[model samples]
Target: MVFKLTSVLALVAALAVTGNAQRQIQGITFAWNPDTPNGSHNLPKNALAMAPISDLNSKAFTCRTNGLNFPNIKSYSSTGGEMFIVAWDMNALNSTDGPKLNGPCNHWMASTAAGTDNLKWFRIGEVGYSAEEGWCTDKIRREGQLVVSMPNDLLPGEYIFRNEVIDLTYAGKTYTDDPTMGAQFYADCLKYTYSGGKNPKEVTTGLVSLPGAYLATDKGLLLNLTADGKPPGGKYTVPGPALHKQPNPGSA
Candidate 1:
């Protein structure tokens, strides 16, 4: 689903008028079902709170609510090549009390039994700033969801997937004034079993831990979304490990 510039501008104008409020991940769908029944797959641990993690060094940066052992949350069945759609509550754009997401979108995955090794969580991909298309959050606000592709080359095993959005609307500031005057980190994870894949990578290189992945002063975090107005394109670097690539069949 693509949106035009006129429509995109309209959304930005509306969001500007409505004001900002932190929103939460409502639920996740295994496939590309935007209208899928709401609550079919359980909500994220912090769905009711609707708060963003300001401190990037805390354990909550790992999974928002649960640390390593995220138990009792409902698990879903997923196969490689399927679409994972993360649905957000309607207030993201409709109500005046929703978030104005103006930052990057990132997702990661790790083996369920990978122990405490932070390097096991490999970055899948990231969608960041675009001079012509606007921020990734713009797309999310337009559709009210963030869609990611399940890694097709991943080994068949129990895995946890995380979808995250960094709200940079106030990233250029610090907590000196208001505690909330900084970048907002919102992340959620879901457990799933994989059945089809061609790789058995347990600990891939370049993986990074969530709590240690970002810093308060990282160039990506301390950014002015308005400074780079009309661009040949802004120099917005995504903060995290490099995007994961499947190792060759028998090389690693």
Candidate 2:
């Protein structure tokens, strides 16, 4: 179980709508199934009851024309639930022009704090890398055979495997008024519609895209995710369902 962050290809094409690469976020959507039975493989009630847990913010990974190494990939498990992973492409921040591909998106590590230790670990292979805008700053690519792994020992709740792209109306501070990320981007959380051990090709064809809504965020997308991706436990969850339903059978 290697929960790595290798997404982009599957969802970016989801949006048929086009936008400027700058100012407006372009080509991004939740890679989801369009045929799975609704209410099936829903997130655990508790997973939806909580807020997204993010320990870090505004990270950038860049790769140069000469190709750079993404040597540091890190992750963290929150007390709230869900393990958050982050790493740097190093190639992201170098030039506003963007990254040079056909290089390395190295295996990486991350830390809970800004130091050499306490950083969580993970691995990635059987994949390639690419970039747009800023490989690290704008949007990046994890070319062909993209598969990000998570620890098999994940908590039994709703989880999302997607990147967040926050957009702030730089009214004055640009981002200060809104220190937000993932303002608008789809989460293929529905992909988790089934169990987590199989290859994505095995179970995700007709499943509808799960609205990036967290079963937690009141915005929407609240549902159940069985430990086995089945129903009953596959029931839908409403806001604060976990508030009264304590000690639900889910985590991660």
Q: Which candidate is the best by lDDT?
A: 1
In the range 1-252, model 1's lDDT, one tens digit per residue, is: 222434333332332212133465665555533233431353534333456788876677777775755433444554465555566655655565544567888888888665555536888878887766677777777767666766667777678888788888787665444576788877776677777555544556777667877778777777666654311246577788788774433332
Model 2 weakest lDDT span, ten residues long: 59-68
* Model 2 per-residue lDDT tens digits across residues 1-252: 122233433232232222222211122222122122231121222221112221122221111101112121112122222222222222232225522221112222122222322222222111221222222222333321122234333233333233322211111121223444222221112113213321121221122212211222332122222333222232322211111111222432
Instruction: For candidate 1, give the lDDT of residue 176.
Output: 42
Q: Where in model 1 is the C-alpha error above 4 Å?
A: 1-22, 32-49, 66-75, 116-119, 174-178, 227-235, 246-252
- Cα deviation of 89, candidate 2, in Å: 18
Model 1 lDDT-worst window of ten:
10-19
lDDT (Cα) of model 2: 0.23
lDDT of 2 at 28: 20
TM-score of 1: 0.74
lDDT of 1: 0.63
